[model samples]
Target: MIDVAEHLAAVLEAARPLPAESHDVAAARGRVLRHPVRAAVDVPAFDSSAMDGFALRFADVTAVPATFRVVADLPAGTDLDPTLDTAEAARIMTGAPVPTDATAVVPFEDTERGLAGGLDPVTVVAAPRAPGAHIRRRGSDVSAGDLVVDAGVRLTAAWIGAIAASGVGTVSVSRTARVAVVSTGSELVSPGAPMRRGQIPESNSVLLAGLAEESGAEIVLRTSVPDEGDGPRRAIAAAEEAGADVVVFSGGVSAGAYEVVKNTLGDLMRFDRVRMQPGKPQGFGVTPRGTLLFGLPGNPVSAAVSFELFVRPALRALEGDAEVGRTSTRVALAGGWRARPEKTQYVPVSLDRTDPAAWVARPTERGPRGLGAADGLAVLPPRESDVAPDELVTVALW
Candidate 1:
């Protein structure tokens, strides 16, 4: 009969971060970083060109129509150090290193060619140029030994690019935790299988598998077992043998005759039927094989809610992510609501913030919420008689 917060805290206290592993940057996307991503070397490494132009001394362009002799042509990646001393310019392309004596860069489009392309101080159209123009200063983007990206950041495409640019060919990232999903029920039939009377389609396994995959977990196994002792036991053993860090089961946690999941788990797990509607029959603990185990209710909405409130946070904690749980917000109830108040209720709700200062939320049935028809879940307090309009209520943001 504990509040949701107390239950959540207990679950969190029992969880710990997963072990780290080395992985390629390409494969590390969406995975949490175990270590700091400091710069191995300065960005740009050395002074290079910011534009394609001729490198010349600023003093040479003091008067109008003044041009310098083209000494040599420098393209990208050229290491030759040609000095520009007396009214001389070096033909430089983009990303080329500037000469030592050069103070400014005159774009080739602003001047005419020297006589016969020989050593001649030709005329320039523009006046005096500024020193260091079109020059990319060394380490302007990043200084040497700078902490480019910090630890605990979720590796992304931008992070990968930064790491590669910082000379990190390989990276050490947290290994994706492996998860095993098992859906149990005697009346469930797999997709593409023939359906029989009094049977429903098997979807919890797919849903659980998709959720695990989206949460940066590698699926070691995805299976379905009948509402029987032997089948569920076999599935549990298979999951443990796959080296899964977490094993999830949908259905058979409630008080039902076919609740083989609860009976088979025996003393290996702890059931927590919180005083919350829509997801009351939720359970989690360690499996017989020492891996984390969670038994979610069979109802689609119930299972989804259980995953959000319990399993999602645990996964995030193991991955070292700070934003581990569903964010909650306060919204004004658009209409009045009355329900049996002894138990906390989770009502599917749609939110609208057309007026930035206030948000309006309206509750609806389960199916509407599944289609993203609701932006959040309205949390009704336990033992409240009625909730009136304009009253602020807590909502779990999607």
Candidate 2:
């Protein structure tokens, strides 16, 4: 038997980041960058108007009730560069390039006529705007060749937009891991199928596949095999042929009789009883072809817990993520619960956010109902039999 930390460390030690590949920036969300992304061009490449207004020298509008001649009309995307002199203004739309001599912009609302009819000589009803007002200066947000995003950043929608604004069309990011989920059991049947007295609908594949996908892994193959004959080996071979980087097997890892995974790949894998509740039985090893293998318990909750505690971090490590673990925070317990002695317990819990700074965790309803309502798992350390109300506990958020 090994401790949870030891097992996790072993798993991480065996996993390495996948090779970097160039991908379109539009499709790189949820992927980690292998190298820093530098801006190819400055944001707001040229000085532009931030609002639809009149562009003129601030000196010309220092006094209210002043009149200025409209020299030209500048709309967005115009290439013509008009110059502004004293008492002269240009009707400029938002995002239009500002004139070289213009030092201020007065919004249409601050002037007479408001450009409602047409660009004509307008009277300034408000005081002059400070110099350089309402102008988005060139390279203000990001200069050309500046670091737009650092390496190991998990690309999000905002990051993609920033990259695009910096004139980056493509990015080099860590490749997503290819995963294969194999559920083993002869008595297992697919969902929505008729079941006999001893047969049950298989759900570990769907559960594991969804979890894997959430962790940024691409599911290449998902299949179920019986416990008898060469079913398990055949499925593993199919996974290898499909170019999988990792193969996850659900069930048949315990000391029970007729354990298919233990019987088939026992020699090739290292099985261990981790000191954790719900998911104590675990197995992991790397194949000769360099594909990682994981054998998780069959029970739905146990399988999900094992995936979060072990497989998810490994997947993240393979993608070169700096933060590979679930987010956790300390919260007060709303109720009391019994914990297993000498073994860690991961109890499902729901949060009370009436006070965000002091969140309270209440144990969720037991059985399958609990799984649905749980927002996080309250981690109970070993040797703590009972918890009191309002006790502080660390919760790993989903």
Candidate 3:
């Protein structure tokens, strides 16, 4: 039997990222980028007004009570000729293009309406204002040919806004991998259903499905099987028929009298009893239809932890993400603890960083077999026992 870390390496080594597919920028949120995204054109595109004010020459005004005749009115998206001189002031609205020779903008509220008698009323206002105060310079935000986003970055809301503002209406991202989840147990009943004596509700299927989704895999099929070998085999057959790249089964892989999943899949799939606690029993092999199959433990906590520490990374690898693996951190044990020398122990523990550089690890009351209500798993090294308080221990973070 291999160690926990070595087992994970073997599983991750078997997966690969899916191919890239073109999708609309609006629909690509949360998906991984498959190619670099370059700016389509100048972000600002043209020199325009940033405020609803009068566009005029910076040198035209001397002091307060300075006046200029409004030559032309320009609203947003309006195109104007570049023929304005120092004597000309254009009435520009916000987002409107600035006419040539304009260096400042005087807001309309700053000026008062002049006499409306027979002449074109000249608005009186203060001037000799600061340059570039209200003008949005062309290419100020981004140039015409700048790279906006690079490949391997996950698309976020801000990225969507940036790509759209850069004139990119579509984006290319990695396609999501399709997955199927199957649960096997005769003692399990659906939630809210009346249970017989000694029966438990089914939960591993839903948990695995959620885990798969978090790892960027799409769940296309979900089903449950009885604790009979024929029932589990039928579920696997159905999962393959649904065209799943990966098929996950829960609850029938452990060592027990009624381990139907192991018995059924062992004939058509490879079975391996791992050396880790809570999830020591496991199996994996290719389905008859060529889909990857994983038989997870039956206990809720064991199944959940095993998927996070093992199966989730494989799904991430199949989604074009390079950072695909469990993250481990060194933590100081809060209390003294001991473990067996041969079997790898996954103890549930709560961690805190009271000091910036040190992590405090507090072991939970739950044992390795009792993982359903655990906070997270702590990897106990196989070479030692009786870890002291404040001793450094490596733990896998969720």
Which residue pairs show backbone clashes in model 1?
65-124, 66-124, 341-383
Pick by TM-score: 1 or 2, better one: 2
Candidate 1 Cα outliers beyond 4 Å, as residue runs: 62-65, 106-130, 326-365, 372-398
Which regions of candidate 3 are displaced past 4 Å?
Answer: 52-54, 59-67, 91-94, 104-134, 273-277, 325-398
**What's each prediction's TM-score?**
0.82, 0.94, 0.78
lDDT of 2 by residue, 54-172 (tens): 88888888789989999989999998778777899999999999999898888889888888736679887996558899999999999999999998889999999999999999999
Q: Provide the clashing-pair count of each candidate structure.
A: 3, 0, 1
lDDT of 3 at 337: 72
Looking at candidate 1, what is the lDDT of residue 333? 84
Query: Which candidate should be chosen as best, given lDDT against the real structure?
Result: 2
lDDT of 3 by residue, 85-142 (tens): 6566777788988886888877766666522211243464766358876788888998
Ranking by TM-score: 2, 1, 3
Report the candidate with higher TM-score, 2 versus 3. Answer: 2
Off by over 4 Å in 2: 354-358, 383-385
Cα lDDT tens digits, model 1, 1-398, are: 56678777866776677878887777777888878877778788777777766788888788868757778888898998897778788888888888888877776566676323444455667753477877787788887688877877788899998987887766666667789999998899888889889998888888878878877789999988888657767877888888888888999898988887887886777777788888888777876455788899998778877777778887777787767867799999888678657778787888887998998988766552452476778888876568887688999987
**How far out, in Å, is residue 15 in model 3?**
1.9
Output the worst ten-in-a-row residue range by lDDT, candidate 2: 334-343
Residue 180 in candidate 2, Cα distance off native in Å: 1.1
